[model samples]
Target: MAPSELRPVRRRLDAHEPEPEDAEDIEEYPDDGFDGRVRLDPGRRGMVALVGVGVAAVVLAGWFVWRDHPVSQPVPALPVVVTTSEAAEPAVAADLVVSVVGAIARPGLVTVPPGSRIADVLLAGGGALPGTDLLGLNLAQKVSDGDQIVVGAPAPPMSSAGASNAGTSGGGGSGGGDADDSTGKTLSLNDATESDLDALPGVGPVTASSIVAWRDANGPFTSVDQLGEVDGIGPARLEKLRDLVAP
Candidate 1:
């Protein structure tokens, strides 16, 4: 065979070539039987579940404590009620019994309250008779309980000669008219007649006669205090007699 006509002969390999590995096939390796991965067994899984349940129970307990234990609030106190009553009034005293005498139309015991005046007693005795002497008498004077009020008769009109004679004898002396006029001589218990004595407070005809008899039996009184020694003369009576008499 000519060299030009000879064909290229094929070469034969002694060993077989390895197949190429793809990137996806290399990453998809199966799990090794002896790897360090953690595994939860039945007991370990139960422990984890119990821890979760314990945490839930703690949260529920805390919520219950918060709901039950609220902030403290102060309670308001109630007001008290008070009731008041009115006071009672005091009672008034009773009236007193007194007698009026002198020149009054009617003279007798009269009912009067305490602190009554002489004018009140005189009014009770039907007022003074016409032309009775009211000089020197303090009609505004207050009278005590059981007091005696007396009115006096008017003096007779005097002539000049008679007045001169009277002035010379008993009219001008210390125990005479001038003295009597100055010291309430219109009501004289010593020299007065029964009618005049009867004209005194609390003195009737009988009491006037008794006073005259007593005066006749006794001596002239030295002081007005001696009037209390007479019968029916008490503190109340003495108080009335004090104004009408002189020592």
Candidate 2:
């Protein structure tokens, strides 16, 4: 065909136009004002938002229920008051009275509480008197009701001359010009006074006084066997005086 006579004819077709393979393979993105652009479907985003709101509502409801519920624990009990018509009474103490005599400065009855000792009784009696013998008494001993405490007088001092005279006269078996002589009467083992019995064998002023003291304490003796009752009189000493006394 000659160039001048060749012509192209245009006609509209009913079928859709086929896309180019190269153009279909190429992707075109819209410009967004961000470095990374992402697209999501509106329906899918709405479903995700609804799920998040439902989860939040459920969490809030659980929190509210937890805050409103009462905790499981034991309740505190109220204090109880005990009232008695008859009140408890105090205990009564025992009353004790003691008498103090002999060698105490004030020799008389003393009123004291129960469970008091003899020392307390002594203190209650104005303490001990001068020259009182405290050796024979137990001051710490407990005192009961109606107890009597007697403190003795202190013994007198002994002189050398008196001691020598006592020893010489008290030594048995000596009939010389010593106190034991023929003219001297045999001393009574129980009731003889010191001056009356000074001449007896093995009998001194102290021993004679001790004999009288025994008589005063135990009453008159019926036999010489009771002579042993005197202080410082042993069996050997009594044997020596066996023939010297009568009933």
Candidate with top lDDT is 1
TM-score of each: 0.38, 0.30
Window of ten residues with lowest summed lDDT in model 1 = 7-16
Error of 2 at 191 (Å): 15
Off by over 4 Å in 2: 1-82, 153-247
lDDT of each: 0.67, 0.64
Tens-place lDDT digits, model 1, residues 106-162: 887888887788788888778999988788467898766645666783332332333
How many clashes (backbone N, Cα, C below 3 Å) per candidate?
A: 1, 0
lDDT per residue, candidate 2, 36-143, as tens digits? 756666698899998999999999999999999999998899899889989898898877766676667887778888778878989999998887668856677676
Under the 3 Å rule for N, CA and C atoms, how many clashes does model 1 have?
1
Q: Which stretches of candidate 1 lie over 4 Å from their true place?
A: 1-86, 153-247
